[model samples]
Target: RSPSYLAAQGCWPGRRLQGSPALSPFLSKCGTFPPESCFFSLICSLGSFMVMLVGLLRYAHVIECCGPSLLNTLGLAAGWICAAGLTMVGNFQVDYAKVLHYIGAGVAFPTSMLFVFLQSVLTYRMAKTRGHYWTGHLRSILSALAFITLVFSGVFFVQESFVLQHVAALCEWIFIINVLVFYGTFTFEFGAISTDTFLVLLKASQAPKSYKSDSSTASTPHGHSHSEGLAMV
Candidate 1:
């Protein structure tokens, strides 16, 4: 039970639909709503964390490469960890959750994703003849500020109802839309990385090995060239 739930006294009996003309009409039995709401919070935390783990694992192929993918994975992994940490705070305390959330969702995740993009572009540019695009700082403070404003503003709406609720709902939707856009863009870039890496590894694994012979003839440089020519024939 989070601090807020504990603080709220686990659903005040008379307070079910209090102050709000909207939810009061549908009483919907008894104390089930509060428990259900708690369960939903748990699910959100678990789901977000699991999804973040999957994203990081996908980029784990570069463990030894010391390449752009390593940076891409690390930045994203940090973001997801921050997100998970915030969600955990939400499970235990509302204020703590909000504070952590503002940092994670608003500051960490988006900025981390921005780094992922920069690393990807840098690595990609390196592989390509035109390698100039890899030069900029992809994590922009302006973007982070916007996300922080949007995130905290939506979080501020959780307890709202009548008028305040509506405004909060609008902010919530705006935040969600922003996240969805980030999701789509990241998905595309991740796909490209996966496909490109797979193709490269596949080519390497399937390529013919250099010709070698067991006899002394194969040990000599001229013999190696002859073996190569013979293999081609």
Candidate 2:
């Protein structure tokens, strides 16, 4: 509807209709108008917040289960950066803020690809159960598809042909969908998370160094016994 509304006002490229062959509209372009732009901005902002929260939870989850690793840290950074880019994309309309919008797009797309790839690698590394293995395999496929689509979208976007541009737009949509689905996959692991997981992290962070060392010395034998019981469970 926004596309058609833009078309009616000659806001679209070549003043073409929504499905016309002249120029396939970018998602940003569809939200360039008044009412739709407001909704677009709101949705993007909310999405960015959700992405950031999810990234933090994932980082904390990894720290809790597998201990800290460089890959997990890097993935969190990439996810947060991508979220920042999304905020910029939503607030800056391409028509009015072309440079800022493109900059945001530039930041968002590559970082999102990196984030998914890193998470996929981490998933494989952390795989213990059959379900974890299957999750890794699914993430790997989605990461590959996302990277391919992102590359094609970028390459075709600069082409002179409208048909190519339409293809590029299609690829862009696919890339976004793939990324969203990748985020959705986190539910598999998140399901097993409990409040104790975060509480342990908080306590570990707040505990004094002297107390930690003393506790480690005192509990070494008991810790081993507890770990074995946990593993068996």
Best by TM-score: 2
Q: lDDT tens digits, residues 1-233, model 2?
A: 45667667685655455564343467887778789899999999999999899898888888888887899989999999999999999999988999999999999999999999999999998999998999999999999999999999999999988778878888999999999999999999888789977886676567677687888899898989999999999
Task: At residue 82, give the lDDT of candidate 2.
Answer: 96
lDDT of 1 at 74: 65
The list of candidate 2 runs beyond 4 A from truth reads 2-23, 203-233
State in Å the error of residue 41, model 2: 0.6
lDDT by candidate, in order shown: 0.46, 0.88
lDDT digits (tens) for residues 69-96 of candidate 1: 5455565565576556546433543333
Please report how far candidate 1 places residue 114 from its true position, in Å: 6.8
In candidate 1, which residue pairs get closer than 3 Å at backbone N, Cα or C atoms, i.e. clash? none
